[model samples]
Target chain A: MQDSEDYLRKKAFFDSLLTIYGRKPVLEALQDESIPAYKLHLAQSNRDDSVVRAIRDAADKRNIEINLCDRKALSRISRNAKQDQGVALDLALPHYGTADSFLNSLPASFELLALDGITNPQNLGMIIRSACAGGIDGILLPQKGCAQVDPLVIKSSVGTVFKTRILRCKTLHDTLARFREAGTEVIGLSSHAKRTLSDIGGSGCRIFVLGNETHGVSDAVSRISDSSVRIPMQNQVESLNVAVTAALIAFRKQL
Target chain B: MQDSEDYLRKKAFFDSLLTIYGRKPVLEALQDESIPAYKLHLAQSNRDDSVVRAIRDAADKRNIEINLCDRKALSRISRNAKQDQGVALDLALPHYGTADSFLNSLPASFELLALDGITNPQNLGMIIRSACAGGIDGILLPQKGCAQVDPLVIKSSVGTVFKTRILRCKTLHDTLARFREAGTEVIGLSSHAKRTLSDIGGSGCRIFVLGNETHGVSDAVSRISDSSVRIPMQNQVESLNVAVTAALIAFRKQL
Candidate 1:
């Protein structure tokens, strides 16, 4: 119960930080007074174009700080410098942070989903939409081995990425361990599980772990799960798409 | 029972027709003799490249007829002239025809999903994969206002398009009416339905209807549906992805 109380508290901090990349999105974010812009980063080698000049003028008018950085530094921040058009912005999103911080503020009754190595940005975005739409409490996303949340992801999520409760972590294995320690059942979804999702526990404060598209749950995380469940299938279909599987488990009856 | 028996007999005439576009995919289809190739289409203006030569030779060896037509004619055959690369093939795929032909083959214990106005190829492909994986009897794909089963849709379906049963109809509303007359329940899924999916009837040869991504079910189809069902969501989420909704209902147990 305490674990969930902590998440609800952090949920209050929704849309607290959003790092938007690319020229158009950055400029749009800067122009939209509604979205809080902290700093604007520009590649030092950007060509003198009217759009670039316009972006700078907008930042100046808004009193948003503009930093000139090398391509590498900008790439690290934007994650896609080639497409970034030498522009990026750091905005204050409402609720987003480390898994620990999110867990500390979790609600007493919640359903969380831990994404494990989902490499496709479109799939990741769609999964986030499903999780949010299903009313899943929070999503735990590892920093590595997955597609970085970028413009494409934002577009595919249909802009829901901004509002969804997202908890980032360095590694999911460790996060699953932490979830287990909190007396929350860390359930892993796999095609080989003996029990179906209907037979597994979904109620209470629990986390459902979905793995990579090609590979099922990783061995490391699968080893520590309280129980593993499979979505029932009729054909020897190998498995359904990972995002679709997440939807099934996310929307499954809690009881 | 007699309706399904009629379909089983017609299933023997598999792959009577298929129109596949794109250079690589058409070439691949031509090389694979296992797939019946009825005709090979190429633009008269196409350069006589090595790969094109190779394709001609393969088709010659397979006794498949080749048509060298103008760009417009080839595009008409391929449906996607820009991406077709001047090459297309008409092969025979298993189990695809008008809704009347498909319904004649459906089994007594069967589940069908009718897609209405789902224009995205990726979503259509994903839905077909899920339907096949979950053992759906047939999918009603309208001839209008939806993504056609093109190369992208085939790629997204991961080649399940070859084996999955597909029922093509002129309009979804007409298809729903046919299902109704056949004593099959045409259940349209809506986010605003009074009864949840759990509360509705799902057994005994029911066709679960899904509407467009942006718009829910078409008014015509909705009016003809035996009952409307909603997937219960906890979070004030408006709706799930159309493909994911199909997956949930396609795999929902029949009693």
Candidate 2:
């Protein structure tokens, strides 16, 4: 019973460190100031010793406990030894602007991205990073059928996930309808659409909905879409990767 | 010296099987019409197994000799357990019509795709597949910077690679010049273009040039481009994955 409790405590500690794997992510978490980090893990055999030293120096300044582990142990925890050169800090997810707060903070006219069933965390992170870069007001992700913001995803996003306002919606269809009612044109991307992305000019506030990798936007979501558009292709290729498709449409809409 | 000669002979046998792997890319070297096998390498343990029976039937019909190796020998030759699957065939690159031939066959006005420096085989395959589905005329891959069509590419293309015309150009600049001479409008996609893809509209025979993933188009290519276009983004996301971006433009051209 005592061992189990210790295990649970370790698990909780690890869970709390999800927000602080990458250098940029950790820095962002630290900037929040209110979020407390208890410990930092540094790999002993990192080739680039500068990053490790900087991390150690920062931890020292923060008065956080530092533990040095072997490369194998760090790899085991990160699940990817290739990129993570063995620096992970225990930190909390920051309480940035909430979805509603961000929306309210945005200018009256703005564009947004709504992701439906994009389960690949790398893809999701890329999409979010793209959305943030494109000046998207916020992102709406389905509560389910979505990859949680994991360490790899945070790395992939280059730390944009920390800054982006991500809202988890119970039902994508209902959420899309809400956008539509709020005077936002909810466009769903489909391969069979008669209209191209260019056909829909960027004249009004818009919300672009990107679908899954295999099965596209659900029928329920499609039914409520103001318009469905497709990216053109040649040479008999059926579809593009979902994240790329989203970037194309999102950028096209902004244009 | 004798062993070296034997190795060369075996290699030659596999090389000779390449011709049978074209188009359908299924086993055609086997003698039996019913059994599907181009070439069969068998282990001693399964001398009378179904796999061996199939190979023998095919070999007998095709009048081809079957090479038998001990399990250890076969394992060494195969390098990986990939050989344990009991069948491995040499698959050929899918046949693509010549650009000139495809152009002559097509109507005067049609859309075309020109890839700048797409190095990923999967991306190339997906681009070809999407291009074919979108009804584009032909694909122009720069001889210098594109991925070669191999077995993996054929599989990824899902057989569409067999139908498309993939022209290998000595120089993309020269090719773009040729397209210009043929009244094909050369458009380059970039992040900083003054004109958006939406502004381009449905025009005459259009040739879209997609660049490398990291760097946009080279200055030389950009200078020769008839029009430079950007896909506008709402957020600050820099770019989309090359294949996905290509699909979007291809679909847009179709629309």
Candidate 3:
């Protein structure tokens, strides 16, 4: 039993590690003092160019472990040999946690965003950036049906992917059901809804759910939602971009 | 003098035509009856697939001219041999007009969005989509220092690029100056502004300026602005995404 618990703990730790490749990305990650930096992997064949030198210096300054390995080992570590640029860095995302843990520590009144089947990485990153910058407290990200955190997402977020609190779940429907059971208000966004975004009042633990690009919210997820609100649109517009909708929700309080 | 007038008119007509490539995009354009269809170009080597048949039928229904050309001629027409999928469509943008002409017909107490050096095609497309869907009347598009309308932009706009009223200008600074002279209120969006977006009243013709991705408004443009306002942000985020900012401005009336 003890061995099994140890293995689970190690697995959880490794799961939180995001291995970002490319020389510039690694150097930028090292430069940001707030991002939790782990071990750095460098290909042995990489020449000591200025950027490579800068990455090494930043790593040394942060006291991060530097693993000089062969090209094959570096490729294995990065999993993207063509774009890794002979370097990779594992970052321990301090703000990443599970939904259960996040709910336990939630405040009495909070506004959160839950993404449902957002497949575009750019939209996901922009949503994260807006949620982090605006009045949103946390983001509920599902493991499935959503874009994974990739280099494009990182770029879109302007590196705020490391700064925002992401509560991961196996599936959004199940997690939203649990949140509803726990007395949290789950609101789904739909274009055909009668009520506008301003019609809803902020008074409790609310999770504003944004849906897919082509389709709105999934039927199963919509069934569990407490209410639905639409952003007021003009000019016969059927819908706003998913990321733009997220921004509107994130900054709704300020508005 | 008559020949010169005819030549000028022909040049203007040709300038407004946008030739979009790719099989799916062309078919989608043909299906949307609202879009002004000019001509259709297809490669002779294309097989009679379902999509190609659909495209031909849609063009036939609309009475649009179909130009069947060889592979080399089709490549020259599309300019994207690899991705055009042996099809291209010419669309005459009905809402596209010059800034001077748009200003002459400006409505009283209107809201407008002006792009200043937005380089990313995706960002430009999202901004146009938001501005089109929201309460904004027109978008002042500078001919310089901005991403030109392309297939990626059309994809990002979700076809709204053809619907929105784009007031073209040679440069933003000169046009902004001309608008200021005509008693239009020019508001620049900056993070450090003391006044929030809500602080401004909703009277008179207003043009909100959104700046570049990395930099805020250019110094030359900022100097001529009547005032500036900022979106209220939290969590130490310096600024929102340019497209997000545009959405907020476009939908500010609803808020």
Candidate 4:
């Protein structure tokens, strides 16, 4: 009973430190001084010897606690049961203002990426990482029909989740309309678009709407788009992966 | 002893089937009707139940043998292993002509994509898929450094690996030189390039070189490039995924 209570208190303490898992992300997170870590969880045995050492060194530098656990326990904590390499970290995610406030805080030339219905956490995580790297002002994801910024999303983001501003909007359509009213040009990426991405010139402020993996942008989003454009494909294969497609659009629009 | 012999025969048959895994390449072989399949593996428990059934029914119509396996076994055979959704066809990959002959066979406005030391099989597979969709005439990969058209590559390609002409050259530099000698403009996509991808004006056959993930194009390959261009990205991000970058280049060139 004492051990169980100790475990519970420890869990709560670790949770408060900021949870980061996966070798690449945790390693990246350690580079930032503002991000504090409470403890490190190293799977009792790990195949990657170098990664294990690196994690230990980082934890040591931060003066953080280290806990060694079984693969099953590590898996349960990391939420990535397939391949954990036996490493996880408790690092705090930086706080950001609300969606409206975050947007208002951006400079005039800033652009934002709005995800309509991207449900894959990996994809969403990657998009967030890419958005942060691309220097977008913030990302606005719909409250419904999208992957939440969960642990899996955080891991795939390579620690960019800590730096990027992600806002969850109640309604994507309404939010997009507000952007339009606020003088932001909204562009929807679609294969069916008659206009090529090159034809639609770049502007100071814009919102690129990325849709679901299979069906693409909803009709409601499409109806409000200032323009719809496509990344011209060879017409032989179906389409590029949603994440890849989103990166192309987001990157190209900034170009 | 009899069971052992049967197992050996099955192993030999599977080895033979493994030879032809790319979708379009395998389709061509199937059209030839010379390649024989002992059995087709299908994940009968996929969410896309109808699609799997349709594929099975089509195979049945072709008088091909069918084998129902669990998703795990099916994943073992697939390259990317993303929810194969109960579908994998045991077909032979067709042989194509040399790069010169393949190039000669193309139309005037054909665009070709070349990869410099892109060893990731998943990226290669997806690039082939996207190339086929983008209507690229052929893909030029370095014989020594690039990923071969393996089963995993085919699976990631969604079968488009077979449909495209894959030219494996001894050296990308030499192949690129030959293309330049043949009056085909060679363009390199690099983050350092001052010219935007949109700035390159061309109406003839074009080849775009995509470098590896970490290192852009090798110095040798970049040296011979007639033009080097960059996809404008927001300053926050360092680079786009190689596959996504390739797709954007393909689409931009197509436009």
Instruction: Evaluate model 1: give its lDDT.
Output: 0.80
lDDT score, candidate 2: 0.66
DockQ of 3: 0.61
Model 2, B25: alpha-carbon shift in Å? Answer: 8.5
DockQ of each: 0.37, 0.27, 0.61, 0.29
C-alpha TM-score for every candidate: 0.77, 0.62, 0.87, 0.65
Per DockQ, the best of the predicted structures is 3
Fnat per model, in the order shown: 0.54, 0.56, 0.73, 0.51
Instruction: Sort the predicted structures by lDDT, highest score first.
Output: 3, 1, 4, 2
- Candidate 4's TM-score reads 0.65
Candidate 1 chain B: 10-residue stretch with minimal lDDT: B8-17
The order of the candidates by TM-score, greatest first, is: 3, 1, 4, 2
Candidate 3 per-residue lDDT, tens place, B5-38, comes to 9999988887777788888888888999999989
In model 1, the Cα lDDT at residue B71 comes to 97
Better of 2 and 3 by lDDT: 3
Q: Write the per-residue lDDT of candidate 1 for residues B139-228, one digit (tens) a residue.
A: 989888888898889878876776678888888887788778888888888888897777755458888888998898889888999888
Runs of candidate 2 with Cα error greater than 4 angstroms are: A1-51, A57-86, A89-113, A129-136, A154-164, A169-211, A217-239, A252-255, B1-95, B100-107, B133-135, B151-163, B253-255
Candidate 1: stretches off by over 4 Å: A1-16, A23-80, A85-91, A103-110, A223-227, B1-15, B26-81, B86-90, B103-109
